[model samples]
Target chain A: MLTDSERERYSRQILLFGEEGQERLKSSKVFIAGAGGLGCPAAAYLAAAGVGHLVIADCDSVDRTNLNRQILHYESDIGRPKVVSAREKLLSMNPDIRVEPLAVIISDNNASTLVSGCDLVVDALDTFTDRYALNRAAIRNRIPYIHGAVSGFDGHMATIIPGETACLECMVPEAPPRSVFPVVGTTPGLIGVLQAHEAIKQITGQGEPLTNQLVLWDGKASQFTMIRVERDPDCPACGGDSRASGRRREI
Target chain B: MRVQVKAFAGFREILGPDIALELPEGSTLTGLLEGLGRRSPGIQKALFDDQGTPLKSVIIMVNKKRQTRAEFVSRELHDGDEVAIYPPVAGG
Candidate 1:
């Protein structure tokens, strides 16, 4: 039940989604897998939108170089864990929500446990190894996952509804080697916000998520393109006879 | 056949947003990619390795439907078809 203060705090957005939707947000638990550029904006919006619980995990510290894109970490936060800084700002931004910060790298060993009880998982990591790990864990947990990534002026996001849509590996079977990729702040900022928007829709059961299609953002031309993604029978993650995947999702 | 090609991300930077390519009446996706590769070495380097195999990391779609690398060699393109190429980004 929303207290009087909780109702007033979310009155503006409540007008758009209504108290029922707001209550859904207040009851959802989200697991965000990074505390960097994408996570910063995604978590901030989810927090501001009054997601009842947020469990954020990241092992990296706030380096001076992260100041440009990781919005939650300030100059004073340099050398601190990214999740710690993010939790501080997220709580301060909306004291009504619960934020759990995990200061650890998301690896194959811990990924499933971290997301065990999450209603939804957000892939904001910078490496595909971690992304793949998180993807498998989400499948194992039967939790829907949101995948978002950006490099330079380009970024893409997709919503993965386990047993219902294509998994990340089904779309990109391989990945580019990890390196210090170049990225402008707004690139991830844009994609991350879209990710959070998708989360809200997924949580509140309000609108369409990016399921079975990738929305590619080209900052150069300021265009958004959607491309269909079909389920792969051999997709090692959510495929084959074991997956129980449904009919092909349409646009 | 005339195929409308759309490239996104780095592919867009090299091949521009959209390109119209004139090819034989029955052209394969690999043929279209080779045609694209002739215009920019970046396309060749990003989409295919030294052995000329399509990189699984690069996504190619035909008429808005995603196609895997295995499908690239066998799938034939029709005139007025829309082929899109993308490289998934990996930064947070």
Candidate 2:
């Protein structure tokens, strides 16, 4: 149920999706895994779109170096935890929505609990380790997960529908070595906004999510390319056999 | 046989967005990669390791379908096949 103020605040977008779709956004709970470059833009858009609740989890603090891309954090928030900085901005951006900031690292043990009750999970983390953890949790919970990453003016995103679509692990079976990757703000900014767009479409059932497809964004060439992907039957994450059991232990 | 190679991100920077390569019929993906590596050191370094094995992290797709590293070395290419090579970025 939208309050009178809520209906008025989302008037512009309401015209697009109607009051029902606006209410769908009001009822959705999205879990964002990072407050870095990708998370900032994703959360901002969802908040502005009137997503009912956002659970943003991050352990890092806002640093001077992060100011270039992590848009939610400003100069004044240099030493504060990223979730705190992001939560403050999101609430101020749209007081109608609820923002829950978790100042904790997302790990295998905590991933499931943190994402509890979320209608969707957004993978905006920089490390594949954390991304894998979130992937497993989403599969276990049977929730859709949106994965996005950016580096050096290039970024890619894919939407995972648990058993229905290729998962993050299924697509990238091996984790790329982690390092201090170079990136321009626009790289993640573009991809993150696309991710938010996918999320909005998902909650309101508006448009096609990037299901079974990887959308690569090249900032240099200024092009978006879609590649078809299929779930791997041997994938350790959501393979056909494992899909039946819903629990498989790695030997 | 003629095939089109579509490389993305860093690969595209070295080899351009799309390159037409001429290879003997039934040439394997490894052969195509080796041919690419011979053309430029930038692509060689990006796609292969010092030991000459395809970097495990680089993704190779044949006609929009993924080919794992093992399959990549063995899968034979046909005329007009589209091979996509890219390194998935990790930064947020």
Q: What is the C-alpha lDDT of each candidate?
A: 0.89, 0.89
- Candidate 1's displacement at residue A9, Å, is 0.7
The estimated TM-scores of all candidates read 0.94, 0.93
Worst 10 residues of 1 chain A by lDDT: A242-251
lDDT of 1 by residue, B21-67 (tens): 89998889989888777776787897788888777888899998898
Off by over 4 Å in 2: A241-245, A249-251, B38-45, B49-53
What's model 1's TM-score?
0.94
> What are the RMSD figures for all models against the true structure?
3.5, 2.1
Model 1: residue A122 alpha-carbon error in angstroms: 0.8
Candidate 2 has an lDDT of: 0.89
In candidate 2 chain A, where is summed lDDT lowest over 10 consecutive residues? A242-251
The C-alpha stretches of model 1 lying farther than 4 A from their native spots are A240-251
Q: What digit string (tens of lDDT, one per residue) describes model 2 on residues B2-91?
A: 999988887887888888998998899999999888987888898889999988778888988778767877899999999998789888
- Clashing residue pairs for model 2: none
Q: Each predicted model: what fraction of the native A–B Cα contacts (within 8 Å) does it retain?
A: 0.90, 0.69
